[model samples]
Target chain A: MLKKPPSVVLASFRPSTYPRGYASALHSLRPCWMVFLNILILIVVCGVSSAVVLAEDHLAVPANLQVFDTPNDGGQSLTVNWAPGALDSPDVRYQVLVGDAGATDVAALKVVAEFPAHTRLVKDAKGAWWTRTAERNWHQFTIRSGKAVELKDGTVYTVTVAMLKGEERIVGPLLQAAPTPNWFNWNLVNNLVLTLIFGGVVFFSIAHARRRDIFLRRIPGLDAVDEAIGRATELGKPILYLTGAHDMSDPSTIAAAVILGRVAKKTAAYETELLVPHRDPITMAVCQEITKQAYLEAGKPDLFKEDSNFFITSDQFSYTAAVDGIMLRKQPAANFFMGSYFAEALLLTETGASTGAIQIAGTDSDHQLPFFVTTCDYTLIGEELYAASAYLSREPVQLGTLRGQDIGKAMILSVIAIGILLATLGVATQAAWPQYFLDFFKDVK
Target chain B: MDATIIGAWVATGLTLFIFSFLYKDNPLFKLAENLYVGVSVGYTIVKTYDTVIVHLIWKPIVENQEWTLLIPVAIGLLMLTRYVPKAAWLSRYAFAFIVGVGAGLAIPRTVSSFILKQIEDTIRPLLMLVPGEGVTFSWNLMNPASSVNVIIVLIGVSSVLFYFFFSVEHSGPGKMVARTGVMFLMIAFGAAFGYTVMARMSLLIGRLTDLIEYSDPSYGRPTLWLTLVTIGTLIVLSRRSRSEPPDSH
Candidate 1:
């Protein structure tokens, strides 16, 4: 058909001239022209840097994923294995990622394991990485799944593996696996040895705890808590307790919690005020529980003022300042420093010493002990803090656990002596006993 | 190189000011201690605002628009209720949540990492002499260690574990085991104690080294000026404090 003249077409366009209206025609035509222009731009842009961006964003999963049992847990965990990505990093590492279902976006990925480049060999398989890949065609990675994760019983759940080059791109063809309960995970071999030792300690201790006269030695540092409290009561002043700066998650802080229980009880019985300044909010909460329990046990629950235990700042130095401020203001007659401490240990102890408070410090932090020893009236050495709960609570479970630890220590000593003998013998006669003896500690590849 | 250097100087001055405590109670030490405390608290407040409030709370709630975070947000708010004495007990609910969650997390991890992992690493075959290997026996190429080292490691790990075991009776075989454990425990303790002593000595040495290093002109004639200024200031302050009545607690 011949095209109409532009002027004629325009002049004919009265409001009612065209039944289907000019607006739709204009709208449709403009978008088509704009889309064409966009296509041209995209083609040019893609042509310029297509290779680089494609290389950066390319992700793939290896074809095969092997699932197996993990050791120690009560039949819950699985170790997953995957082939390494095709373009795996020379310098960086592969992070094993997992999710509940396939087709889930990569953003919701869970990190299963991070394997260093040098230590790529799995404990179960003894072959070299090259040989293993030749035989199985799958590079191995281990994922530990606890009882907490439940993929549908019979349904297939997708597993994806990605290699992260530090904080950069996660490159992979995502692997998918349908996890079934595996009969054996070769990793369990190592776990089996550990379980035996743990059971041995617990078993022997529990058997020993049955005896009537198990002589537990006195820890002078722990024994002085009472004396410290007594002195504070005599001086007509409050007792201050700092449970270190760490949250209750720290073992040292837990030890502090246990010590606090004893101190709280003693303070309650003596009708002396107890002041606990905390650095962590969680620890402050734990201390409150311990204090209440102590007061309740002492039959003075009413005297237990919750506000006496305060949450200071969570910052290390700030917490130190706040506690020091309290000490300078109150001049508490006795200070109990327990749990884990850092640089603040010196600062707090010095302030306490200056105030003439009889400070009893207990912590597993070796670095802080010098300051504690120099300034505090009494200090618990390494592991002494761990012993406090057993001393105070006398719980068989706790006591049993300690006994296990003791047994474990004894076995270690006997070996050390034997090893020393072998070393000396080898030196004296140029024998190979040291080398022979040292072989046992090596990791089974 | 900029504020870090100035900060280092400030830190050095403060450290010396505090160390002056070893000689005698002094005002310069108190001033440094107070400034340290104030600045540290300020730093913490800023960090907590940036991390816990911003990252853990506000980002998740507002930026991510995750409404479920309201529970934690409410609990965090309850923790601040301590400023109000009457409603202070309300904070316990927050405390309970934190403690409960923490315990739940810790027990399983502790059981696995420390207790289970330690035990797993300890036990080994009583005899690791692999037959038909060699005249003297060889280290297992498949495993990390030779047989003898395995036994020694097992012994070390078990004995150490035993020494800390406090619940059982120390009699008969138990006594024998306990005694062996104690000796092992002592040696380990000794080693640890020795290392600790070394570490503390190092720190003392480090502090002294820094003090000496400050004598160099390149870093500035810091030691001389710092010592003289701090001493002079302390002397003045001590005399003033003596003349004035002590601040009552």
Candidate 2:
């Protein structure tokens, strides 16, 4: 049964003791009470301010919204202008999306215009057949601010704007404006081969899950984890596990935590010391719980040390440095790195190498893989890191998801093959045959 | 050189100095590594104090003027109480709060992102492919090139999603679909793998290219020579490891 949280306001507090004559006790108590009362007063003030801060959020838009006179030297393209949205401030970059009403339903949805808020040009797309007039940065684009759009002068159209900030996608309340669709949009080919390939893998995994015959290529990096832990036990040195700097929200961090569970169990069973240094407080707490559970499962609950998994500063390089310091001082015989890593990957790997520690690393960060592969004894690449957790846990849910992903990969492959064949034939024929392929693959904003 | 220019040169020089480890480690690399460690730790301390203590803790009380800060304060204190082995159970409350909120945020977002959005996007308007004119699979609509591409994309998307679905059994037609999904997945993974391999190899090539370019200068060649010498020394020392007397405890 879950316990209800203690009510913050109603919680009891024990007053500190003051053993003395009544007069003296009263004198000392007066100051304590005064300080407590002052703190209470301060809390009330702070509380209101904090609430205001939370409520102070407003959509950030750019100050300058205007039209650019630059015409497309080639054709009917008109330069649309707008200032950045206030929400992004000076730090965020934006994505520009353009949608047309005559297009498909999804296309009619307000496309991200300038996301970072700095882009100033958009080509006019209205034509006589579509009969839509171009509108500027108005709520409803009808009048093409001094710019003439060649549309049947009487048709109505609507246009809207949306602001994108980082990963936070926010569409501005729809601004209705009329805009004629013009300019040649290249036809884009869907990524058929890639899709087929993903599909195939997922299918086979699921099929095999039933018959229990799926042959997963052995990842040597995974195989080495046990050996690394054992080596540390033999050497009487602690085993250090570094979960990537990202918080628990990142899939990579979750993968790292899952891996930690396995490593913790091994350490518990072997009676070897395990150390996990975390940069995020929440990740640290989760890891501590996982470690404790692993030890408990291994019948070594008494040996689990809460302090073994602790939070370091969240700064990337500092966390790296602190781990390096730990490496130098404790000289852990084995080191495991699993999760997202960045430039500091090299620094940490080199330090481990210098210490002659056996290191195993797994991460999805494409940029950092090279350093890890060269330095670590074994490394899980890209998606394989995610797969490792699913593989180890063998929970039905994880297995099911893995099966799905496999299918996605297989589907991707088939489409690629088909696309290649068609493109080759079109080229051989020297006709408009392959034009369809080229058109379908064209990128739409 | 002006001081600023000299500083730039110094920083660049140090970067190159540390980067030399790809060839072999030396005292220069060690020095740069130590400096990096020191500076990085200093930076982290400032960030942590600012973010966790000042913003999360102090600001609520001193600057933001909030009584509700007491809730977080109490939770934080509860977290610390876990250190006391006797009262460790109390720590679960904080954990529950953090985890519950995190889950609340994650479930909706993940469903929207990975499941709903992706799935919805996959179900494209199939009618768009049908020719408005004559039938017989109008190569106009059925441009073998684009048609094949769309079909492939449809197959990939469908199979991949199908593979992930746990409720249904992948048998008969489902088996075929699932198998196809796996094959497609492998190809995609293979392509991704190939790309990653190329990327990593490129980095290695880049480093080597830089080293080769550096060797063109007289000052740089000596650095290279020094690196080679250090590597040679390390190799000889490593060979003597077995024969060396054991350290006295």
Candidate 3:
């Protein structure tokens, strides 16, 4: 400025005079500074544009968000369902968020469950009409959250689904629902219907049986009971009866007790020694009374020894060991193992088999049935264990129950046949109608 | 000696004593059996006291202020009245309540679990061959499960169910079905027997492993010492019994 320097020099120059090398250094640094500034501006502009693109690229919100109380529950669960949006990809996922219905900020809500994309809906429909009308194409995912997730009965909750694609998220509109307790679940209507039908059949059969005589098929095992007792009487040895390892409360034990009464009466009539050992005290007491009553009925009350039905240790293996010892020592002519058995079944049956005892066993215990079948002279498999009481007692009431059970089984078989036919047709034709038949047996809820 | 080592030794001794019954019933086995019974009974009593008396009865009534719990307590106490000959009849009330409640609870669960579930599982698609893919009719020795297996199951189930139909006489075709049912039953039993044997062998192996662990130096080889002692005792007892006269019943 002092000596009317050039415009370029004036623009680059500071107020103070510089050394000779400084001007050249300043000129070189000026170009570097301009380049750095240009780069910084470019980076800022690109970052802003990228952020806008990211926000715009987010997936569309899921449609038809619905919330409702879970049916057939103890009023502690809520179900969240939503129709999936257009965004379907491997990288996409959905998360269910739950919050108080009155909450102002959706972002503050808690994420209850997260599911991968294309989660299939669980159908809660029954019968042909419902199955036909059900949505087949649209994928609607449902999530059930219970009280364990802080969901309470009677409290309204707002449920929303969020689709997550990469780092971007778009949430659907919230739907409000409250969980209410139901005394009778309509979802279990099929179960109720079946039960009532079976119960009514049983009752009707029992009533009908009282008025007329019914033909009964002979059970081969029942035919051998008297023969086994007679063999024991001839051998001058005691008859061993085990009511199994269960308490009196078990149905098998009740059946055993009933069968034991029949056996006791026969033993009492023949004057054959009877040995009954029990693992439970209650069962022992009940058996003692039953034996006494049997003896009384047989007109040989004095033959019913009080010591016959005695309590052994409640320990499983220990009782088995004791029974095995008795089998080895007493060498009972006939051994009757009735009711339920477990791991000790083989141990007991094997010991009895070795002692040359005529063994007959009946049990509903499928696991131990093989042991009984192999080692014992005869075995009553599964339902035959239940049928033994009626077979031996010949009570009208019991016979009616058995007949009703048979009818129920017949109904089940017919259903199975129909189901199989429908399933085959469905597979061959690729038709949806067969699904209605299959859905009848399905517990949809 | 460490407490844990002593416990291992005791356990090993008891296990060997119990196992000694395989030779013959002896005093040692009887002692072990009685000890087991005593321990189990004691444990049961303690558990009952904790669950029934303390938690269910006392805690709820006192801590939770649930005074209505007395009704159940009174009913439970009545169950003990059976020991008193004069008031024995009173126990029937408790028995009735228990039986009624148990029956009410069991019926629904049994229907759902046993009956309905079994039917649902049985009603499955029988044919698995694809239409356009063409049938590959090769016998897979390793995997017997196929459409044929489904047919076999259906036959087995229906035939067995038919056999149990007491209303139908086993005269004509019924007898044939019943015989087939019997064959199926036998096969099922054979498989179950094989599985049970495997299970029992596994239990034996587990016990043998425990015995081996107790044979370690830290346990002072309790299994070995116990085995020797049990064998010696059994020998002595057998010799004594052989020397004595048989008791007359």
The lDDT leader among the candidates is 3
Model 1 residue A404 distance off true place after TM-score fit, in angstroms: 11
Best-matching candidate per DockQ: 3
The runs of at least 3 residues in candidate 2 whose Cα sits more than 4 Å from the true structure, single-residue gaps closed, are: A1-240, A273-275, A301-337, A341-445, B1-17, B23-31, B51-64, B82-90, B125-145, B158-249
lDDT of 1 at A214: 49
**RMSD, model 2, all Cα superposed?**
30.7
True contacts kept of 1: 0.20
C-alpha lDDT of candidate 2 relative to the true structure? 0.62
Interface RMSD to the true structure, each candidate: 7.7, 10.3, 2.5
lDDT of 2 at B162: 57
Q: Candidate 1 on B1-249: residue-level lDDT in tens?
A: 567556557766877986786665556656876776667668878988999888988889889999998987898889888678899889889877876787667654555565434443553333334455323433655664555676656655555455445444456776676577557655655565567667668987988788777666765757778889988887887788789977795
Residues forming the 10-long window of minimal summed lDDT in candidate 1 chain A: A127-136
lDDT of each: 0.67, 0.62, 0.79
Q: What TM-score would chain B receive for each of the candidates shown?
A: 0.73, 0.67, 0.88
Candidate 2 on A218-328: residue-level lDDT in tens?
Answer: 556777888999899999999999889677767788889888998999899999999898878778988998999999999999999989998766667656756777787
